[model samples]
Target: MMAFSSVTEPLRAANRVGGKEPYSWHLISADGEPVSSSSGFALLPDFAITSSPELSHVFVVASIGVRPDRNAPRAIRVEASSRSIPHRPR
Candidate 1:
């Protein structure tokens, strides 16, 4: 999972309910470091997208922005799929 900053709880819940154990779910960041969410949560990625092996799926979990806010970056969406990776966001 590309795991953009939010939706970690829901993803974990879905995996638990669906019984789909990730062979290896890795957290990734643009800088190979930690990212903070709008909701005050912080995530420490396991690797940087540029360095990780190609994945079957990359999920970008971003919350709906405030009225004056903008959407998640286009690059994040593009990067998720550029390497033949399927993207899912929730």
Candidate 2:
């Protein structure tokens, strides 16, 4: 997604310029499969939440065009939300 890339580009560029990789990131989706953005471009996630490594920060990017299935229960989301993960201060 454009917003996702825009948010991370500066961090990545800084790593490049500094040559020390001070920042790194991962793209994650509800499942491990690739997800499409509002513009229909798909991005493959590095890992699913179930299998992700320890994280320092979490950022959520959403699109107004996408809507959840009202009839179905979101089991994975519910389970992920129940976890008590702590975030590192910036």
Candidate 3:
């Protein structure tokens, strides 16, 4: 939740400052269902990845439950996008 909020709040603040909705985002899940955060809060996604639109940017944040090792879901942690998104392991 912290990671997601950290990325989004800035865009929200930008909209508030500009007095218009200059940035828009959609919540997406692999299955198009509600995903649970580390705090157990549920977020309903707008689209499933297979059905997603042409996005200008895609942020695939692995949940706290995921392991960053080789066993992690290949589709989730896309290698190409990972170059832009930093990885912090615990």
- The candidate maximizing TM-score is 2
Task: State the lDDT of candidate 1 residue by residue for 35-87, as single tens digits.
Answer: 66667677788887667777766664555552322333544556666776555
Best candidate, lDDT-wise?
Answer: 2
User: What ordering of candidates by TM-score runs from best to worst?
Assistant: 2, 3, 1
* Candidate 1: worst-modelled 10 consecutive residues by lDDT: 66-75
If ranked by lDDT, best first, what sequence of candidates would result? 2, 3, 1
Tell me how candidate 2 scores on lDDT.
0.73
RMSD per candidate (Å) reads 6.2, 4.6, 5.3
The local lDDT score (0 to 100) that residue 44 gets in candidate 1 is 84
lDDT values for all models: 0.61, 0.73, 0.71
**Candidate 3 deviant stretches above 4 angstroms:** 63-90
- Candidate 3 lDDT score at position 58: 70
Pairing residues by index, what is the TM-score of model 3? 0.69
- Model 2 misplacement above 4 A: 69-83, 86-90
Q: Clash pairs of candidate 1?
A: none
